[model samples]
Target: MDCLAGSARAVPRWRNVAGASRTGKPVIVPGLIVANVAVFVLTVVTAGSLNRNFASPWFAEGALVPALVANGEYWRIVTSGFLHVGPLHLAFNMFALWIIGREVETVLGRARFVAVYGVSLLGGAAAVMLLSNPLGPTAGASGAVFGLMGALFVLLRRLKLPAGQVIGVIALNVVISFTIPQISWQGHLGGLVFGAAVTAALVYPGAVAQNRRRVQIVAISGLALLGLLLIGAGAAFL
Candidate 1:
């Protein structure tokens, strides 16, 4: 851990390096949008007179269901986000990404964006794992997208961006949760918490002075604690 030189005061000059080299360039997380579009198209094509019978294929039906995921159909949970039940569902999520992802990718660089998004997806999976019933179908990028919200919030704070704007957007999304059913609030909340934590760890590496070190430590620890609580709460609900 590289401590800030000399003075044990202040936040070590806010040196925002362009994240680690591992991420390569900010990979356009088009995977989420692209995957969803393709799946939706396939679902429409295969509906074939069966109206909504897009699930004849084990692969398509497995998208929203979690038990299939634990039982080796694991790829579907990740892939399911790409497929939507309808155009409206896909449009809303992709549009949200268009608005927020670019800024975050710019801040953390391409590599960090990928890390944050990937982890958030995993985090969302954890929620479905704990709460979803046997083969309970699940889909949507809202969880991973919420993870973006969490990550974006942290980065905005780290860079000292305008708070009113950022926080308002978050609150609005939260409001949307109440009005929407089949929204998978579980996944969204889980991903949001995880994304926020990961971003905090990356942004505030504890290699600094006492005050900052303590702050970073506390922030990271809080994230961990929240994750534990979320797990417990989710388990209780299950």
Candidate 2:
């Protein structure tokens, strides 16, 4: 099966729509993996005994985590997605993305994939801000990965695909989350929920494509609102 097949298989089924080379092929997702790997090399090399936040460039942040720290940077919300605390961390997440992202992006198209990813990242960030101690910082692409998985099954359901395996895949990750320390459970769960919502809205049949658009707009708006609220709340604590 192709990239689109993997995503659609995660839960429900959605047919493929042909596109240009970028969205039609499998290169973009792996390219992202390479980019992330390159960044991690820099992070590990820099994060010696002297600097605790050496890998700060990899984590994502905004008004909440970065805004609180004196030396913290603001663009972490996007940057953090590229950073991994250890080889294992990076490998696992990248692998998951490669397997899931390719198919989802292929099916959703690049622009929509980007949209789904961005919303999921924000959703992950929002969850961290709301639940975690404001003073503490959380980062990783697992949230984004989790988001993709959630999207797969939900998207399939909307298109009338089988959803039997989706729950199993999700539960496996959740088990890993509880068993793994320093893993961002908030981010994972948050991203998963956000991705599902977005995919569901996008693919959900409503008698008219316009209705689907309405569903997506409302869902995206809700996630954005929640992220902004977390930013505000984090600022308050600081």
Candidate 3:
């Protein structure tokens, strides 16, 4: 449900104190990629083909369906983020994730990175549940991947580095979302907005500031509440 094509060039910035806590190689991003690939393999095997996985019971049970969500299958918001329509869909999203997610992880460290991703994923699902057809299926990590792009943009700007490249990438992807046949523009926009907002809350806590972690926790939690509210609104609309 996303047309996440092309790679964005990484923005340059010095590692901040938060990133200094990162003592070793990044495990979260690699682990996410592996999980996505494994789930895709399972879906493909279940359906007996690369292209026909959508008809598999996995999709029936997992992919975001507004009608089903309204019926209390709320797990779709999380599970659908791991589902993809095909190999091309998976490749595009995971490639984008690998390119953008590692940098975000290195900058924010593992836990904060996961927080941003989780919030952005939920934001995307909320948007889809609100705006997309109630019975139509939508799935992909592009929403979460788009969230990484927003985080990178905010982080680059926080360091006073040039951020035009990130903006260009976002703009281009927005264009693709509109032009492509099946791309979920709603999910893309929601992820971008929430990603930037959450990352701003995360990195804007000054390095030497007191209660910085507490402030970040509150801000992220608030955004998560807002996303949940939006999901409720979507379900109500259905």
Candidate 4:
């Protein structure tokens, strides 16, 4: 039920051609990179300081603060994925995205790649709402970047590619997530798990015969609903 299952079974001649073309160009990845960078530039231009912008209205409005989200700022879940606290943060996340995102986008294609990223972003926001400080704000693309890592991990393994490097990167990032101050380990963990789940659903063998597009839509919708529920619960409990 993998996205590439049909392609994998193609005749040898076609397989080589497909492989070459698949790796040749990725449309969504570049657009995503550009969008993230553009948003960061806007944030920096408006906020004046890369490292400290909590005082900036964009940060205040876009960052995932449980209290604000609970009070009806639901858009933060998506917007926060585009905002970064500093250049270092943006650079690290965008770099990871550039390296990993292009590969994943190539494999998943544009639409599915977008779905995985959106789910990962919402999943991270849900984790922040549920487990992070209700009053503190969290912002970055790390969550969605981590999500891409999870999806890539599954994808590489499925293709019989060496996934040791992916596993190693995830392990290293997990360690950093816990040790780094102000980092949202919850968001990272949430995005990783959610991304894996979503990707698995997307590539499920049973879905190969079914309407794959419909399946992807359902899976993404379910994830989005779950994220909303988590946000509601967080608001209620925390």
RMSD to the true structure for each prediction, in A, is: 7.2, 4.8, 5.1, 4.1
With candidate 4 superimposed using the best TM-score fit, by how many Å does residue 83's alpha carbon deviate from the native? 0.8
Overlapping backbone residue pairs in candidate 4 total 1
**Once all C-alphas are superposed, what RMSD does model 4 give against the true structure?**
4.1
Error of 3 at 21 (Å): 1.5
**What TM-score would every model get versus the actual structure?**
0.72, 0.78, 0.91, 0.87
> lDDT per residue, candidate 2, 66-168, as tens digits?
4453244546666767766667777888989998897788777676677678788877876776666666666568888898998887766655666677778
Better-scoring candidate (lDDT), 1 or 3: 3
Off by over 4 Å in 3: 1-20, 206-208
Q: How many pairs of residues collide in each model?
A: 7, 11, 0, 1
Residue 197 miss distance in model 1 (angstroms): 1.0
> Model 2 reaches what TM-score against the true structure?
0.78
lDDT of 1 by residue, 134-196 (tens): 446667778778888888777666665555666788788877765787677767877887888
Find the candidate with the highest lDDT and give its number: 3
Model 4, position 123: C-alpha lDDT score: 83
Off by over 4 Å in 1: 1-27, 49-61, 133-135, 208-238
Instruction: Estimate the overall C-alpha local distance difference test score of candidate 2.
Output: 0.68
| lDDT scores of the candidates, listed in order | 0.63, 0.68, 0.84, 0.79
Name the top TM-score candidate.
3
Q: lDDT ranking from best to worst?
A: 3, 4, 2, 1
Tens-digit lDDT string for candidate 3 (6-45): 0112222333533325325668999999999999999999
